[model samples]
Target: MPSQTHPIDPVRYGTEPAAPARPIAAAPSAVLSAVDAHAEAAIALLSDLVAINSINPLFPGIDRAAVIGGETRCTDLLGERLAALGAEIHRVAPDPERTNVVAVLKGAGGGRSLILNGHLDTVAPFTPERWISGDPWKPTLKDGRLYGLGSTDMKGGLVSVVLALQAIRAAGVRLKGDVQVHAVVGEETMSHELGTSAVLEAGFTADAAIVVEPSSQPFPLSVAPVSAGNFNLEITVRGRATHAGNRGAAIRPGGEGASAGVNAVEKAILVVQALQTLEEEWGQTKSHPAFPTGFFSLVPGVFHGDAGVPSVGYMADKATVGYLVWYPPGDTADAVKAEIERHVGHAAALDPWLRENPPMFDWKSNWPVADTAEDHPLVRTLVDARAAVLGPIPRGRRETWSLNAVTDASFLEAKGIPTTVFGPGNLRFAHAVDEHIEIQDLVNGAKVLALAILGWCGVAD
Candidate 1:
């Protein structure tokens, strides 16, 4: 927590002077050699971490103790590694079972500070047998990727940071700016309030941050400066219930058709169809520069309709539909909510039952946008670092790039700490049957991060 401290002797950081270093080319990669030297160590640690089942217990529909609740153990393992590197470690556990680790290797003072963040939790492997890697818990190396449950979704990220820090410490480079390595929990479920946000709420932040969230796919490994906002909406439709035999009576011309009763299932179908038309309209109307055409969407992920019981003999009395919506940056979640309610409200007015008893909305999770300007120093330095290390930047990976999905970067941005999403793992395998991250991606990412640190934090002469 203190902002400034005496400059650590450069010799203490490496075997030689911290020499005026700028890793965007110009400076020798005496420090980066550590990454190559310990490449096997990085892979070993990644394999070890992936072996642990750190599935988030809070994940919906999963509460098995045998497979979940590994956050505290994972956090402890990282703490030990950072401690071995001489960094001061602090552990924050919002839930007694799930702990977050913040390892701060304070700078000697002068340059900006930075935080490298990643989550420790993983989504439960629904069926371990379906995993082509043979076992989701035991990492299998095929070609160049290390396949495991958390490898790509991102235990690989943690490995990259450790490698960078280890390389820096081994090179004996005393940074002018502070570096905070944040290994958190609950990211798979957007529980930032208890994870990333909690770390900041505890006053551990920096001038800028890079969430090592997986960003590969439809493009090579890249840096993303922004992410879209999203929300989980559940719409409940109500209707009158009566005996199934009343269906004919309700529909017959000479029967009590007008006042017999209403079928909630039929009414719910109306709502679904109405929203589909709006979703198609959104495809043509809404657009963001970084996102592909029609990327913003309203997905009906879950639908339920039934009476009080599962019996088909009774007419359904109620129905509920759950939707996941993604909106572009510069837009508020409230605006998106209001738009949906308004669209459905207008459509509801068409039906007698819906007009009388409108659908009730219960908005669940809200993940705000993580928006950072492309011209910011953090962005510029990372771009320069990428160019310096990889050369000939990959296509579509320009500074203004965006992430395919939202991440906890939003929490840091919300706290006024500029943040970006950049990492080694490919998004194609994230949360897939055989999740994995390229071993080369990890090494490349570590090199870039090492370079970024040298430039952004500045080298103490």
Candidate 2:
């Protein structure tokens, strides 16, 4: 298909002349009225989205499908709304059961495009019993917070994007450059092969993109520079089964009055200790502006020990130790894997018991580092627009440290498009027992988004 072009008038899309250098007063009554009206609509949309659960699991069962299916319904409903507003809608489905929706609102100028991206999936509710006051799937508005699964993690941010677009439409604002609203899936589990990755591969291009991830209070816009890669190591210790009744006493002591009868668990513990030492050493030096001062992190998030039945009659056959490692952005995936192998190699060499019982290691590659510069036009426009909308810009580093968790931003960045993550809500609330988002934060985020789009796309003042 060929590119489509739309005619635009620059004079109509450009901002009005700046007022004399003086403090601008609060938003005019009319502007505030418009914002309030749109905010009400945004809250309604967020509540609706929160009502539908879109939890992504490794193997989704019928119940899970019902949840994911809601994403499809949301996309379809959003598509119709965008189409009614004169935007072109494109639906991309990797599987017949899973779909990604893109709604493009063309500008008259036909200049560069901007993308507002959001994911439709949330981590499954771990313990519904722990949800003190309300059900995890049903949204509850208490005080100023809207609670439910996916409320803060990002359904609120997604709804904000939709509301921003709707507000612009309602205000009769015409844009100079196109805007694309992309709602994708499979972000919770790093299954890039299925969601935004598919959308980019299908030829979606934008000059810049913003992922609506929850940001901390004061909503300091974050531009992530480095992301950590995830890897895992598995160590196995093997021991010979011997008759505990007499064979153990027959063997002569080797060193320190120690016999051949060895405890595999003890050996595994030594290996774990050595790995911990390595992590401590590495942690002392690795530091990045976005990340906490540290070299990297090696945590034994999971471990497993299995022995054949009849423990008294047989020696432990095998022990498996699992360790997770987070590598900094500059570290190559291959290098991280090699480092794990080296640790295992050192463990094998230190203990003869380990030499006889080898350790195995593997890495689970995460999305490659995704970054955007502070000086980029997209960044500057958003910053300027934010300052314009919310007075007195906050001071902090421009970059954000990757959560070590994967997001759809990876896919868009991989396509050579500049991307950053920003939105409302506190990320700490994400996946929590009582996940919720502040109504005010959601409205403010929508305002920032609307202003940023207007500033970047050159919508007429």
Candidate 3:
């Protein structure tokens, strides 16, 4: 669709004198009041969104229909709200089940454009018995907090974006540039592919972006402009099954025993050890100023093997291991891939069996490391806005930080749109049962975001 245009009065968009700058402190009150006026509306929207089971069905045992319904319902609801607020809306669904809601608040067109993006999908509530809150879909508000599966992870943040936009509009502030909000799907499962990444691929652009991803736990008000890149790797080891009692007869060149077969599981153990050592070296030497934990993490999260039928007491012939690798900004996904290949290749050469039947590699779900300079206007705007709303800055808490987990923000960064991750929820609580977000944090986040948008996009009188 073509860019929408609106006629603007000459005083604001043309020769008239520009409005005097308002004190930073004065900015928050109006926006905050507007947000407060709609406080109940925000909470109700969040509660309704949380009640939808938009869990990514890609996880084991999750119902696919639930995920479809969740994404469809949430996106539809957000689209309607945006329309009611008078923003131009676009609904895109690369996958029929997962729709992305893109709402554009067209500005007077003289300032930088801003994009506020958030995901709608949450991870399936696994092992709910561990949840003290009981039902994951039944959202509960208690002691100034809202508890549910997606509340903290992102539904809360999503709500904040909607309300922030509404508050800005309610205050009768017209922006010089456009403000776009993307309510995406499939973040818990694909991070990008079926969500944010797909939206950008379809030709979305902005001067800067703020992903309303949660920032809970140790650093509640922290902003992450830099995030690590990550990908999933699968390693397959081949072996031949053999009987345990055959012994020497099986070892002989012409022997009919299972000794001739190699145990792939045994080979897998060596690979794990080698990779762990590499991970240790990375932890000790590489570090990002913003991301305290350094980079290049290789975690083997899954492993499985198929041994020859136990009835024959034969050795296993095949093994499989799944790994997740997170690399810092300086490390490219290609570099990490090569490093793993080199390590595994060298280890394979050491064993004759592995040399002939080398372990196979399957790399998937790759995303690049995302980093924006500390001084970037968008980062500075948000950092300042956060400080203004939350009070004096703490010594250890800096304006900018990094996230260990990869997010859809990286996709935008790859597109050259400076993006930062900020919002209300804790990453630790995300994907866990009984996930929750503080009501105060949600309100404060909305105020901060509104301030950032007003400053970066430039409000027109």
Candidate that would win on lDDT: 1
Better of 1 and 3 by TM-score: 1
Could you give candidate 1's per-residue lDDT for residues 98-172 as a string of tens digits? 889999998899989999999989987867888876689988988878999999888898888898889888898
lDDT score, candidate 2, position 182: 83
Question: Which residue ranges in model 2 land beyond 4 Å of their true spot?
Answer: 1-33, 59-68, 217-226, 232-262, 308-315, 392-404
Report backbone clashes per prediction.
3, 5, 3
**What value of lDDT does candidate 1 attain over all alpha carbons?**
0.82
Q: Pick the candidate with the highest TM-score.
A: 1
Residue-wise C-alpha lDDT for candidate 3, range 3-25, written one tens digit per residue: 11112234322343333322355
- lDDT ranking, best first: 1, 3, 2
Question: Candidate 2 clashing pairs?
Answer: 7-108, 8-108, 13-460, 286-294, 286-295
Q: Local distance difference test, per candidate?
A: 0.82, 0.67, 0.78
In angstroms, the error of model 3 at 316 is 1.2
TM-score for predicted model 2 compared with the true structure: 0.83
Q: Which ten residues in a row have the lowest lDDT in candidate 2?
A: 1-10
Tens-place lDDT digits, model 2, residues 406-438? 467767888888887777777778878999987
Q: RMSD of each candidate?
A: 7.9, 8.2, 8.8
